[model samples]
Target: MYRFIMSLMLVLPVSVFSALNYLQEDITNDTTWTIQDSPVYIYGNITVKNGATLTIMSGVEVYFMLVEGDGGFREGSELYIADGKLIAEGTQLLPVIFTSGGDIRSDGDWGCIAVEDDSVVNLNHCVIEYAKAGLIFWNLSSMSEMASSVNYCRIYHSSEVGILFYNSSPTINFNSIKNNRYGIQTQGLSSPTVNYNDICSNYSYNFRNLSGLNQDATSNWWGTTNINEIEANIYDYYDNHNYGVVDYTPFLESSYFNEGGIGDKSLGWLRSIFVP
Candidate 1:
């Protein structure tokens, strides 16, 4: 698998001056809010609230300490993105950290770090690991129309899938998704533009799609070193490092390696942040 094989702690950057002031002033329950440490049995939904931006600092460990005491695994955490947004914009040098609390902690320990369907999710330069999946986008129609831009991130070592996209059209680029049951799982017409990623070494296939939209994975480092002809549709480019079935030789001659994926702004149906 394409696992990092080491546990790393990245230092995050401080919020910008204006953004910091805005966060301190607009955010509610800033002090009373609990920094999730132990497996706290959350029975209700947790919302960040409008005008309240929760800035998860980098290298700050968040442990989903859910326990399966006596009986089977108990019902754990469920973070409701009722409103507001989560800005986990970590840097390449200082990436944000989200992991289980204990040494032997399993994946999906807590509920998940969910971005409400109606809200905007901007995950830049973050390292999401050791959860059921790095991120989850659910109920696209209910949440805000803003699309998610997951860039320069590394997601690995999860129990289930890597990134799950339900009814959202997020742009995933410059990411390294490896060492998971499934790398990227797209279901129910969730059109995600995935490209320029090193998607390799997963237990199963790198990308899985069911909605049958224009989901593209191109110019990526697909766990192989062999250099040969390039193919796009219906070809396992990872194992062969080229066209496993289809013939992309004409495009390769012109140096056309990408699938020309459309960005979030061009989607014309969803709302999203800057196009990176």
Candidate 2:
């Protein structure tokens, strides 16, 4: 009886392992997911077909592993939600992360996360950083064109613009956007409710208004020198939130340090508040 019990235990373990492998293989062979040429790269530029709910699972690290010499990325490697809703709903602990497989220390690496007009992108608890830009919304024709809202996300270390709302009116609330060229750009008639965000010293304007009618409301912290321009809702040369001055640290060292030891105190506030 003892010999038979030991044999059963060994057989059960093998069977369970085999079952798990089979399940994994079945998922790998799923026709829904199309693996691109680069194993780590995936494209979302193509129009999201109707009746298909594309869900990217947690702990899945999708990187834009396109190098400069390797013909570069084919226009849209990041995300281009032209029509359908791209739901990247991640939890606080298991936030869906999108990163560029470039040197983390280097500047200007990958592209942006552009969700076009009229499309619903429910992105929560995601870390979209170290790319070209964080979120690029293009609906500049009018204020009503703005449609997306990013909540509880950390958008940092982007190449150019952090969160660029070109012509779209997006309610950018409760996000930590830092260390980029332009922190948050609102051009044309995109009058988003910019409140409760830690938009600190990017390269150029922290929050710029190209169209004179753009309304940059209140309750948010703009850590640029041109705080008056964004605060008073005025347009001027000095109002340009130029140069990284959130804490005088990123300008010296390429590395970005959160408000902890020797950085500016305001940056800590910017990193804390959530507009939502």
Candidate 3:
């Protein structure tokens, strides 16, 4: 009898372990996503309404579903914050993961984490990948006191831009931004404090400033320290006099690449062997 009961337990479906599957919904009140209910699936857009807070605990895996066709903006899943707050704090050993649900995943597989309208967001020790844009701050007024910060995160494999700012200033530091079309892009008077990051090997320009506003991006490792090589990888005022300049002077002497880190682990064991 004991052996039969043990055998039945082994044959149980994997869904038995899953806690909650959140479909398309609006978070109107304060909510906490805990680690116990891990591997949460977001089937549709998750909009955090005004004055609400969504707290994500450590080691939580948030998977966004893939939408078909070019109308990803209208159909794909995303985390949208408008006049709300998002606090996602994770530890080094067990960081949070935001990834796609499709089996054949690539860049732009899903939408992005978009923050707008005086929303406050803080992401630490997280891994965000396979999206149009990993993080985007848009339409924030100059007088707004609410600020966003992304630190110690791995944002990669984006089809469009890893981090984009549209008339918003966010503090971005100590992150690994790589393997995307554009590592970071700013427009419309957006001046972000971008420093201490490993921004490298993007398909196009590593950094681009289109608003004609000078950006202070110092002390970063651009895969190489050669001034000429780094300048060639960036599209700024140097490329066009009308555009803003990315001050990449005094670059880091050594590469701050951390192996076996957040996003590195998600790249799969076989792929990481050749693609790092």
Candidate 4:
């Protein structure tokens, strides 16, 4: 009788494990989540803390469960990183994906991927969509060999903001941040080296500067060559005197990365012209 019951439990456990992997609790140890376990479902608020490292290999998709209308992400499911590192090393051929699990195409389907307080991120070739805020960087002083970077990613359809930079500096280049309420919002003296991105076509303002510090956001395509059109989409010093002005001159006349996929840009450097 004991052996029969044990066999029953083992059969069901293997079947359930093969279907989905639910992730929660604190990641206290250095771990690697590979593509073999492709779809990781976030069941509750999970955190990577205590200077640990969480490396997510290429072609992995992270799905977050959500409440229908609340969308605050207080529903026990979110990913937060503090005093740690999240190295999601995706490539041009295969990109990492983050989206909702509710089978809905609406924005605010989930919360956000928040990285704060000395957490280093090397996020490349990723597609983050349908969240309250796609990614949030707060109070990180990443530098030198541990410099943080967000490259060759597609961040869009966020209900509030595509990316929020607060008191942090990361090399943000070669990204497509569009179709959101706010493409990028800066505050708390955040100074991201914003370049080589397609920042345009958001529902509200593309860029807003509440940090009150002059920013040098340059060399990026704004979906238009007309200065007035570009300025209209941004909320900066022109809209409010207290805010800092975004210097967006020498911008790219066309999209730098290819439309085919992530990091499919041409070999020769592009200047004031088409990038891909």
Candidate 5:
């Protein structure tokens, strides 16, 4: 008599696996990071070389691993666009996320998204947190249309400045910049259009003018409508008249406290889920 044996097989879907991770690399051509690769890890500095474009899709999560080195000295996991372009456009419902990759998360976990000279950067509806600086514009070109634009973004929990500008004039509007050491810092003739943002609850200062150039920071909510409270939060020419004046007059009547979150709403739930 002959007997036959049967066996069972187990198969798993591709989506059940973890997302793809990347190391220090250069993007010399146009590339798109889709949402299917959720939680893409950046183990080291990723550079978009000259004449290249790096586009990130909505609902995508980019995690920056904490490497050993000083991020301020440009030795960490960062997205550097040098003479290149970065288009990170996310919808309100599915905004992109940039956060720390380690299990123990805190401020200054990674470097920043640095847009170097002659580079173009645009970020919309993105959540950037737990970094040295959320976004940085460094020595941008003088071209009128090459300004780095940041809108409807929630940039917070940065160990250093939230958004830093160095000789670059970008249009910054409708962003929730709070809970950082400094909300926005400008130097070397970097005069950005700072308006319609909720700048409050920062540790050191909300808006710092190191360029000594007059800045137009008006029509923003400073956590309170009280003039004394608002003025105390800003460190402009008034603090030391040698610096350029920061015209922060005509503050908004309504407080934008609730606007400090990811996407169109606050990410309090995500914070609770991750900060454990």
Candidate 6:
């Protein structure tokens, strides 16, 4: 009977058991992560270099190993895209998820998806959480043609800044940024359009402008309608002269989130984004 069972195991289909796609090495060539290969695990730092493209289809859940350290990508896992293109587009129903491994979750569990250099980035309808920093755009080469955009996304639970733009100007809109140390921080000549977002309930300031350039941060819901309470959460020229002013007038009094958990611009119709 034992010998017959051993032979039967060899004949059975591989789908009888679990299937996992483990990634440890760097992605040098163009790669595509599909929904069939759901739950793609990354052990360490994965860099998408120049001329390469990494596409993650909808409903593809990505887990990064979280090794606590110096708040950098030393032992912790990270997805660094520099001089490459990353198109991670998820739908309103099933969005892409980037979270830490294991069941329990916390902030700074992993590093982040660092979009730098002359890379082409499109992070639409995605959910990113439990990171030291959700998205960091640093010194991107192009100002217009190569400008990166993030839309209809929810970024939260970051120990540091949710979105940090340094010397790079990226388009950020229609996102729910909450429960972070700093919701958004811009520095070093960064000129980003921060509009139509639910920038609420951050630990520190919601928007911090370190650069001298003025920022247009209008039409965002800062969790409250009280004018004094709203400006209290913003860090800019009023606090320090060197820093630029964050014009957050014409703010949304209350969130217009629909039943689908999306804040629609047109009465909150609900659109695409990541995570559950």
TM-score of every model versus the real structure: 0.62, 0.62, 0.83, 0.82, 0.83, 0.83
Worst 10 residues of 2 by lDDT: 21-30
Cα lDDT of model 6 by residue, 161-186, tens digit: 89998887788988899999999998
Off by over 4 Å in 6: 1-19, 68-75, 140-146, 256-276
* TM-score of decoy 6: 0.83
Q: lDDT tens string, model 4, 105-154? A: 57877888888766888899999999888888877443321278899999
lDDT of each: 0.52, 0.52, 0.78, 0.76, 0.77, 0.78
- Regions of model 2 farther than 4 Å from truth: 1-40, 43-52, 67-76, 103-105, 140-147, 223-276
lDDT (10s digit) by residue, model 2, range 132-174 = 7778777634534345677777788877777766567777776
TM-score, cand. 1: 0.62
Predicted candidate 3 versus true structure: per-residue lDDT over 117-227, tens digit per residue: 578899999999998899888874653313789999999998889998888888999999999999999888688888889988999989988877888777777887666
lDDT of 1 by residue, 141-228 (tens): 7222346688888888766777877777778877878887778776665666776776667776666655444445545655543233
Deviation in Å, model 4, residue 168 alpha carbon: 1.1
Clashing pairs in 6: 125-273, 125-274, 126-274, 127-274, 264-268
> Each model's RMSD to truth, in Å?
12.1, 12.4, 10.1, 8.0, 11.6, 9.1
Candidate 5: tens digits of C-alpha lDDT, residues 58-90: 999888877876444355689888868998888
Worst 10 residues of 4 by lDDT: 260-269
lDDT (Cα) of model 1: 0.52
